[model samples]
Target: MGAGRRPSGRCLHTGGIVMKVSYREALKMALREALSNDPRVFLMGEDVGRYGGCYAVSKGLIDEFGEERIRDTPLSESGFVGAGIGAALGGMRPIVEVMTVNFSLLCLDQIVNTAATLRHMSGGQFSVPLVVRMTTGAGRQLAAQHSHSLENYYAHVPGIRVVAPATLEDARGMLATALENPDPVIMFEHNALYNMEGELDETAGAVDIDRAAIRRSGEQVSLITFGGNLQKTLAAAEQLSTEGISAEVVDLRTLRPLDDDTIMASVRKTHRAVIISEEWRSGSLAAEVGMRIAEQAFYDLDAPLARVCSAE
Candidate 1:
């Protein structure tokens, strides 16, 4: 099997022949596909033009699409972010890269009050087809300022959709779906997963924006998580399996709509649950998952639900 490939009675194969793309390349391809398919689609962010983006995900895009469509903005997250929202209001599908989620705090007013509330406040008269992409998670010791998983903050809002693209497929397909949605969408890409290589099945269909995916299934316990903690949870699951505890891992890709049905189904089957999140333990998304499990699957539980969240 390849590094990321799962066996299906075929012999092992590697050397990147079957799976030849990096996570960053997958995202770039998705953006390229979106721009090619939609005439109104454009990207704007700091250093996105000649600088090739902070992580180089936008590298060469400006060359192909020209400076007009792949416009670069100043270092003002609040200004460009608000402008992106305004552009969306004016009938444009805008993909605004915030560089990092920590910096996105500067634009919280626009993201929360404007982009998130416009449609509801207008009684469905308006829509913001905006996609804001940002790097999230910690591990490189970029310190507190440069590193933090703020997906929960976005998920707490009601109107905006929060998504975390964990796998290559998600990294590839989410941009198009977010662009198509009539509401603002915030995509959190873990910094640690950018270079991780994986397969890209061109024939694979688009993943739903409101569903959870079972990456690995088991019966003894359920390990629920999304985003950066996904790989860690899978590692923990494998370790648990060594001791005879089979862990079912559910990737809650969409946090806001939160495929509760998928979570409930997994909990029902496994009867034991543990949620892992990189955000601080207090009032995090993990707590929300635990509460829902208590409310709906309390009687099905063989033990109290467990959680492993970060402490910052």
Candidate 2:
């Protein structure tokens, strides 16, 4: 069985049961499960309820949960998103869906200034148990306006957990974890991965929202990335392997409480690092990681850190 799948022997068979689901389907299931399990949980965004979401990830949910719980807000990103933060503060768990990360910029004030700062500013008196979901990345050639990976922007903020659900397991588990967090949480789903199907294990546990995960092990060079760049990094790793350079791939699943120890440990073992990101190189997350490597792992390095970031 693949890493994402449970063994066939472990499968439950009450009377010959068989079913399959895609990554997108798994995400819907997670959302539906959250709604069914908790009345406090509700979804709000443009086209989310009646239109079935931009990618159809929320399809059929409106009928099941009704319009109140599964709401379709107006096209105003800042207005509706800010409203979500307010709703969360009012003791409701709102899963605010931004059509895309690029559009999320219009509501940066709410996300960074409001949702992220509420808990700390209130001295823990208030908690923003909110989840903001947005599609990110630039593979479909949607041009600049529609295509941008803004996970780094969110990751740079404090008091908010930034997550990228790269696999089927993460797609299924991240929603519940995000809701459980007392602070705000942002989940970036790569636009390119919505239809990429993978098997989902029934017993998969909640992935740590604060730790980096090593997706592949190697000994020569380290390829560190998250979100949509992960697949590119892995492909680069494989190509480098053929050239006699084994590349270890590290997926920084959660960018806010960055698992720097895991990243540094990998760098210590490999002695070389290559940070990859879909964001532009200048002032990008890759640049931040490179700076950290130089600061902490300067003495342990075999060579200067390298980076492969998107072109402006």
Candidate 3:
């Protein structure tokens, strides 16, 4: 695996070891690799440096990389986020961490206005190679303010790419790919998945952030979802299997650029579909995905499209 606390200078890949770790640990590994591999990469956000990250994902990074690389800023999302975008403009790869999706709204202008549109607005002469990461979805006792799945809000924007990493491998590796992209990328890490444990191959590295993955294969209904809801959907699929219903589970890793190909393909095979989202049903990513299936794979369905989504 990653041998030391600070595996310095171009050590992003690993091999030949299977280790069990929590989602939180996997993310730390990814951060370690990114900061170590690239001189241009640095992290800045509230509580990320001295406080060891809001969720403890960046716990040991400050000690490993120092405050300069693991910067801790004041509680102004818009200000610090704007600073990150400026760093990107100056040819520095910056990772801005907003504590939660609810707080990310405070920096909407910086993300949607500056970082997102810079490349196009500059007639392709410049690019904001920035990555903004924030925890999304609800956790116990956090209430409505700190707990919201606002993937659709960012997904609606055209210039930036949005990705929600569900599995352990994605949690560990997607950061690498997002950092590599020239345009701004928003990574929504589900609040509930931080402590979830699973086996991750040591060789895991940057994964494709552009496509959907089929978690399970079945001939009946297709259960499509992303982020924290994925585990619940997989459990639901297992229950359905017991009732003799073969449900195929589709993990929509990249939400914004919805993988219509994998989604439609699953619907075509299963001949039925159900989309699950933690976000409210109105204007949710589920609604967008369902509409696409209706337009492209409507004829192949054996039953009406269904959705299990948030009510509020």
Candidate 4:
């Protein structure tokens, strides 16, 4: 149940406790586990109850946790998000699920101004132990409005911690970690990754939400990305390997408190870097990564920094 080590066991064939599940299932499992472990943890969102979530991630949770814990709110994003903040402030840990990042704009004031800033403004008198989960990115062709990868917008703000769980382990582990955090945490899940299936260690529980992780190791180039762009970047890295290129892939799991050390170390080893983001080129997280590399790892670069981002 520790965050640092993956659980080991005997498989059915070999007697190990490994289970294969979709990314969506892993996320549901995490939520189910959080609710079962903490009575204060309740899930609130549109279509999260009888509708079983916008993406069906909470299909059977309502029956197990009951209606009080699995709350179904109206279409008012601002109202519910603010209520979640208030609930967190009052001693309840609320997991607010905004259907999409596009809709989160309706509650920017509640999230950035209230949930994020209360502790600092109150001189540490209050903290928002809240978790907001939403789908982000542009793979479903849901048109311009529904497909924005705007986790960067939240990441740019102060007082809030932003995390993107791009892999199965992270999807299963990070929510539990975020629930334990004293501050508000916004978790952005890529729209296209929900159905992605992979083997998950059944014992995977919590994970540290403070650092970045190197998903793939290499020495020729560093491909740094987070959230929706992680899988695409890893795929591109694999393609490059066929051409004899050694590309390293770094997943910036925690976005707000960017892990500068992990990123700088990757740049030092590779000497070249390419930052990618699902967001547009302007004011994107990839831009921040590029600038940080320029500022701290400038001497380590063997070539000019490259960026792969959406073209506006």
The numbered model that scores best in lDDT is: 3
Question: Across residues 1-312, which tens digit of lDDT does each residue of candidate 1 receive?
Answer: 121223123223553224457788778878888887888899999999888888888888887889888999988999999999999999999999998889999999999999999999999999999999999988576788878888889999989999999988899888888888999999999999988786666444356788999999999999999987888889988998999989999999999989989999999999999999988888899999999999999999999898898776
After superposing candidate 4, which stretches have Cα over 4 Å from the reference? 1-15
Give the lowest summed-lDDT range of ten residues in model 2.
Answer: 1-10
**Model 2 agreement with the true structure over 93-116: per-residue lDDT tens digits:** 999999999999999999889999
Q: TM-score per candidate, in order?
A: 0.93, 0.92, 0.95, 0.95
- Compute the lDDT of residue 36 as modeled in candidate 3: 93
Candidate 4 backbone collisions, by pair: 9-16, 10-15, 10-16, 11-14, 11-15, 11-16
Better of 2 and 3 by lDDT: 3
* Poorest stretch of ten by lDDT in candidate 3: 1-10
- Residue-wise C-alpha lDDT for candidate 3, range 1-312, written one tens digit per residue: 232453222323355556778888889899989999999999999999888888988987888888899999999999999999989999999999999999999999988989889888999999999999999998988998999989999999999999999999999899999999999999999989998987788778999999999999999999999999999999999999899999999999998788999999999998999999999999999999999999999899999998888877
Measured with C-alpha atoms, the lDDT of residue 204 in candidate 2 is: 54
Steric collisions counted per model: 1, 0, 0, 6
TM-score, cand. 2 = 0.92
Error of 1 at 244 (Å): 0.9
Task: Give the local distance difference test score of model 4.
Answer: 0.90
Q: Looking at candidate 2, what is the lDDT of residue 3? A: 19
Candidate 3 regions exceeding 4 Å error are 1-15
Question: For each candidate, C-alpha RMSD in Å?
Answer: 4.7, 4.3, 3.5, 4.0
